[model samples]
Target: MTENDSSAPAPDRAPALPPVADRAAFEAELDALRVREKAHTREGDAIAAARRRLPMVEVDAGLELTGPDGPVTLLDAFEGRRQLIAYYFMWHEGHDAAGQCEGCTWVTNQVRELSFLHSRDITYAVFCQGPYEESRRYREFMGWDMRWYSALPSNNELLTGRQVGSMHIVCYVRDGDRVYETYWTTLRGVEVMDYNYALMDMTVYGRQELWEDSPSGWPQTMDAPPEHPMRTNGRPIPQWSRIEAGRSDDLTPGP
Candidate 1:
């Protein structure tokens, strides 16, 4: 058959396909899975409840971070809000935009429309591991308007025992002038910022990443190793659109 023909599988390789079933059979299978889905959702809610109850640790309110207006403290970053969600963005110092962290770009680009969090009296910001001026240019290139700051100077104190240079989400709450860290997560935990992965999980192909437990012949094009799955053509997938749209990817400070 020709490549366009869908009637038969190619002789060289078996096409990946899900087993076909009648509507009744499909509904029966779906209903069975729905029970587990509901349970998973409820368990998630319970876990969130537990997270809310977890005790917080005190962090120095005077910890310095470099913002647009120069030096600002951790307390200042909250912008007078009672709560804060800080994404500790990984950075590759001295590298151009394309050489920066792809995983960080994957999650950070998804964070738009912060009014929902602001409505709840929460502030969201990025604490980048690179210098403010250089990284701020990156933020502009990526079209991010949410607050951005350089956490490099305060990295030793802020990250402390945690691994530096890794992507992290840290939750904080303040009372008067005292700041406390309520929760923190890294690696796949940062997936909370991603809607793409969540939606892909519901699709038949499911992320197309090699790490998943997909059946034989299922397309797993997102393989990794020297490069990340979130990247395409040497840059993060999202950067391509911005570059194509004539946006500058230069991280150098403008005059």
Candidate 2:
């Protein structure tokens, strides 16, 4: 029968499995891996310590960003907090919700709890690249409650020397009225906001993506279509749930 034929019986295939081992053998292997994992964790802590000591650059505190209450300065985004974590959300000028950046959606969707950050005097917000009203609707559709603002007018000044259209996690601190950019990271660096990836890393298949080094016969279709792994059925994977829940993805302004 043809591959697409419904009447075709499923081909008999052996399941890909790890070699069987006794409980003691498995525990011994796990114990050895724990040593490497502990070392890796310590290295991560060291890197963060170095990051904390890095010098910061002064930014135009008065740079304009459009908020729900109209235009506001970058300093205002801190909301009286000592520090701010602004996510520069990539935008498609005229794309609908389904056409938005899947990677950004994936990371942004995972940021739900802010009280933990707030307790440490840090505020988290999104500085979107699209128009305020247009992107605000998208935010509403996705049920995101984080502070949202349009950084389009101040993109050049706010993200100087950085690619403005890409996703970024910029950290800032306020000294009285002066705003200083402490640190910023993009690309995989933004994975710090993702719990899914962290959990997937613990799985036997390890994200099940093309880049992972897996045993033969392991499934690697997580990167299917090869271009957008975070997307499914022409939309970001998370957007499908919002759509199914009867939320509006229309970005157009309402009457």
lDDT of each prediction vs. the true structure? 0.89, 0.88
- For residues 1-255, write the lDDT of model 2, one tens digit per residue: 333332243366343788999999999999999999999999999999999999999998999999998999999999999999999999997778988889899999999999999999999999999899999999998899999999999998888999989999999999999999999999999999999889989987677677778999876654236667787667887787777777876787887
**lDDT of the structure predicted as candidate 2:** 0.88
In the predicted model 1, the residue pairs found to clash are: none
Off by over 4 Å in 1: 1-15, 223-227
The TM-score of candidate 1 is 0.92
What's the TM-score of every candidate structure?
Answer: 0.92, 0.93
Weakest 10 consecutive residues, lDDT, candidate 2? Answer: 1-10
